[model samples]
Target chain A: MNNKYNIFLLATIFTLCIFVLQSVEAESESVYEIRNNQIMEPLVEGLPDPMNGREIVISRIGNCLACHKISSIDESFQGNIGPSLDGVGERYKEGELRLRLVNPYYLNPESLMPSFFQNKNLVRVEKKYSGKTILTARQIEDVISWLLTLK
Target chain B: MKFFLSLLLFSLINSVAGRTENIKGINDNLYDRPYSIGELKSGRNFLQKETLEMELDDFDNPGMIWVERGKELFNSVLEKNNLSCNQCHNTNKNSLIGAPSNFPKLNKDNISLINMEQQINICIVDYMEARPYPLESRELLSLSAYIAYKSKGLPMDIKIDSSNEKFFKRGKELYFERIGQMNLACNQCHNHLEGKYLRAEQISQGHINGYPSYMMRWGVVASVHRRFQFCNEQARAEPLEIGHPDYNALQLYIAWRGSGLLFESPSIRR
Candidate 1:
């Protein structure tokens, strides 16, 4: 009778432990889903080679070269303030890169990079571009296309 | 023992909740009235000279090199065009003195005004038919600092009309907005904590008079917009685009705010 009581108690403890572990895992998974859901929809679309569309990126005239260093091409170019982009294609997936280019600080809240797709209402600006996005939707697409080629 | 443990956990959670509630209340009242231009100036005097040694080797003295580089660029004729800035304007430093302070002026011919840097780029792109250098490029910095250095000692006099009022207001909002995981505002450090330290460096009042100034940390000259870009990044907030309207508005507001402060281009910082 004593042996039987001990076995019952052990089983009850094991069951409780499993239940707690499963609940914690479920909570973490839901949290991750919610975070991903908050990201902008455009970021989920696709990623392309930014180098192939260099003309478009440069013409969008948003000036990514001012801070970034893309060493695989353009021997004359040298900008070290921002990070290097030689292997950015391999480092991040299309969705991750898109989100970063659109709004870098969203991923690393301390990032100094500007948000290209953020609502103008949230960002106060002067009269001319007050309500306007810095880069147009197509321009952002072009830049993203070019960045995807950096691998 | 179980009851005591539960009580401890409950108290810890309650304390955290109370602190969070207090922070939310403070954020809700973020905007009180900003001090007026006159009022703010009275408290902050830009003219009060410090007794610190002014040395050329100091990283803050990028003004000297910028002026030299600007002179070189101004004299050299581009390959596309055999024209130089010296062709139109007198090359003499005395002649060009106080020229840059009156920029971003209205142009009746183009029906659009241009800043000093924009004007330089226009000459380079249109007249010289060359690709304009990037905004924060070393060449741009040297030229801008040289030009601003020529206007050293001139009082800032940026005019604000009804068209620009909205821009000024936006700049003001940005100046005070708290962002980042740290949740710190520009005013929290620049306003209330001036002369204090985050770690080792003492904070300045963020006066903009000496902009297009040299930074020791960067080992190069930088424009006010560049500095603002740096600050935004430091705050862990998204930076505005260079030459973005928001940044331009902030520039205008800063120039206006530091109106009486003597232009101190190439000034040094820690």
Candidate 2:
């Protein structure tokens, strides 16, 4: 009887473990809902990790420094093509920032800023990177989080 | 306080003397440095201190190797007419001094721009009755460097009038026109980002007062045409041929930009 009970316990534990694993996976893969130029905060807590976001903003991958200047980073020279990104967080909400990162042209047709999370309507894409976003969804979230800290 | 003031004054003078303006501005002429609201300085001024010191060291500069080889080649007799470059142009009074400072002239016959190397080819093919050296060949590069070396300190004085105006305009348009997958024009970086870091390197006024320049990246002497190919490739654009007529016109315009700067051919770069 005790052996049978032990078998039943083991079966129960295995089923519970599967349920826990599925919940974690579902949480991580949750789709974001954007409305009226604002987006929901990231479901994956570490994705738009503020630290990694800062790194991306400075690299050629973001090329933020190429067109926009950030007063925080004290470098010899900065570009003035785009507005200085000082206090950008205070100026823009999380949703607005997310939309800009995903596709600036969606908001303003003439915006020169490239879409980091979508890869349509671009020119001269190399074979290696064709039909791919400039950054992953996680990178976009991270940059958004980092930009929010500018205030 | 005095030391700081002197340092400031020194930098001020350098900032003023290191560059010049066409006075008429960028649009009307091909000679002006585009996107520059201020004076335009040579790329030489932006070179690192160590690089500048290396260029000043005449004996150690790697470009000297090509220059020396060029001297030997200039005197080498062609079996055809017992002629050499020395036979025609290397005279005591008419020595090649300042010869390189003025070039890319309009060939009256074809109405095409003829640079120094092309002019050398003309002499060999027509005057000496020998075959022309292939473009960018070691022999040609050597001869070009040797001739450029003769004009080391002379100020740039290239001629530009009706004969070469159209070519100059074409070059100016090419400079401002964005290219490659990156979609960056020369003015975007060389002008807009001057003194700023792009790919982690300083941008100077895209001047080429120093041709047959020794770039540390190539580890040998490189002509201006080779460098143009590099710029295009870096932007992920298809590079034009080294001796393309369009490139020649661009060269003519850039040389004019270095109007007052002394020729520092065989100079070192990194």
The per-model lDDT (C-alpha) reads: 0.58, 0.73
Say which candidate scores most in DockQ. Answer: 2
lDDT at B192, model 2: 45
DockQ of each: 0.02, 0.06
Clashes of each: 11, 3
Tell me the tens digit of each residue's lDDT in model 2 across A44-67: 456458888898888777778867
Residues B103-174 of candidate 1 have per-residue lDDT tens digits of: 554443634445567767887888888778788788877777777777776766666666556565666565
Identify the runs in model 2 with alpha carbons over 4 angstroms from their true place.
A1-91, A94-142, A149-151, B1-40
**Cα RMSD over interface residues, candidate 1:** 12.3
Interface DockQ of candidate 2: 0.06
- Report the lDDT tens digits of candidate 2 across residue range B80-146: 8889888767666558889876577777585688888888888888888898888888888889999
